[model samples]
Target: MSRRAFCERHDIDEQRLARWAKNYPAPPRLAEVVVVGELPSARSSSLVIELGQARVHVERGVDDELLARVLRVVGSVC
Candidate 1:
């Protein structure tokens, strides 16, 4: 059955339904999904990295680039 016929049979107000439909539009479709990189799982215990009174607590599976920069700063200064 058509929407109008169904609405009529169900005793629904067509004009009110049409107004609501116009007011709230349907969600847009997603054209494509891109996966940049999978996130690492949380570690059971945090890893403590000490740097001369300054400490940085990190979880497991940290990015290599971040680790490199941190080490360079600590090693260069100390």
Candidate 2:
């Protein structure tokens, strides 16, 4: 990347960038990726909501309105 392009992209002053470059030369380092938390590795996660004897197998990407309606109908029975 050119000095002009870098400065323009970062909204940095040219003179300040030049001074910083001279003062603090970038150190050679290997690229690293840090993962904080472990994610659930389930193949298919479906919400099996149980209300008494009713077992509603709600799959992912189900419409909110439709889910609500289904729940309301389920609640009426239970």
Candidate 3:
């Protein structure tokens, strides 16, 4: 049924419903994603971050500043 029909059947004020909807919107819908390529193997010494079209491999004992810089660059590009 249409929103108007629903409101009419329930005796709900459309203006109030509109205000409530604006104040409390529905949660976002998530899209379904399919992985076409093989994922990297999990290693004890490193971590992998997938960002859109970019993949970040972080090894153990990596410098914080360097990782931040790389993430920043990848984030911008991806």
For this target, which candidate reaches the highest TM-score against the unseen true structure? 3
The per-residue C-alpha lDDT of model 3 at residue 37 equals 64
- lDDT (tens digit, per residue) of candidate 3 on 1-78: 666886798767876555444433352222344545664454567767777999898997786557756766786688
TM-score of each: 0.36, 0.43, 0.45
RMSD of 1: 21.4
Model 2 residue 43 CA deviation in Å = 5.7
Q: Model 1, residue 49: what's the lDDT?
A: 58
Deviation (Å) of 44 in candidate 1: 2.0
Ranking by TM-score: 3, 2, 1
All candidates: CA RMSD (Å): 21.4, 21.5, 15.2
Q: What's model 3's overall lDDT?
A: 0.63
Candidate 2 lDDT, tens digit per residue, 1-78? 777896797667877556444433352122233434563245556656766589787887676557655756775698
1-78 in candidate 1: lDDT tens per residue?
665885697666877446434433452221232423553345345566565676676666666456655655664575
Question: Which sections of candidate 1 miss by over 4 Å?
Answer: 1-45
- For model 2, which pairs clash? none
After superposition of all CA atoms, the RMSD between model 2 and the true structure is 21.5
Per-residue error for 34 in candidate 3, Å, reads 15
How much does candidate 3 score in TM-score? 0.45
